[model samples]
Target: MRKNPVATKAPAEQVVKDIRRAMRKLHSSEEKIRIVLSGLRGEDSIAELCRKEGIAQSLYYSWSKDFLEAGKKRLAGDTARQASTGEV
Candidate 1:
């Protein structure tokens, strides 16, 4: 008789990792902007802000970099022309 693979138990470590991944919170774009802006305010250290926001410092820095880069690109007129409007 063949044993059922579906009845096999996953390793404990793998189960823990799966649970953690499943329970991880997903942040929205607006929430990311809010966290990034809070970090930039300078009232608190980035580490402190990250701790308060329940995120890692690396994640905060990445968001800040993206936000600033986007602003810089906008100021440089990278998207100045709309796709629907033909240039005169």
Candidate 2:
């Protein structure tokens, strides 16, 4: 008789990966900005802040980079608008 592959339980590693993926946290834009701003304040070491926030240093750095780039783009847009208004 042929065995049913689908009826069998998943492998331990696959089960663990599935659980982790399901349990992953989703951060809101506001939450991300707050965290980035906190890191920028320099009240605590980046490593310490990450540890307290229950996140990795790489994740913190990624958020920080995104936040700064967005601000820079917004400021540039504002400046261009101001110059155009002045010309008119």
Candidate 3:
């Protein structure tokens, strides 16, 4: 294990910013879906993905539910509009 000198420690503000940057990279539903899907393809384990991405499995499930619900709503809206407008 490598140890850093206490005198050369990074500032708290910089540490916080770096942590936020890492999270921000995975801060979108599309990104989450891609990560989850890629994991499904055996590139990595779901637990590993969650760990590396700094997310909980529950959060991943919630995002999946939200994505499915959003797609359903969009499809329903499109169907209603097409029925009213006779737009096939």
lDDT by residue (1-88, candidate 2, tens digit) is 9787766646766899999999988999988998999999999999999999888999999999998888898878854444466677
User: TM-scores of the models, in the given order?
Assistant: 0.76, 0.75, 0.44
Q: Write the per-residue lDDT of candidate 3 for residues 1-88, one digit (tens) a residue.
A: 6677664566866898888888754476568778657665778777787888887878777776776777798878854443555654
lDDT of 3: 0.72
Better of 1 and 3 by lDDT: 1
Off by over 4 Å in 3: 1-26, 39-44, 78-88
Q: Report the error of model 3 at residue 34, Å.
A: 2.4
lDDT of 2 at 35: 90
**Rank order by TM-score, top first?**
1, 2, 3
Candidate 2 lands at a TM-score of: 0.75
In model 2, how large is the Cα lDDT of residue 56?
90
RMSD to truth, every model = 5.6, 6.9, 9.2
* Pairs clashing within candidate 2: none
Comparison by TM-score, 2 against 3, better one: 2
Give the range of the ten consecutive residues with the poorest summed lDDT in model 1.
79-88
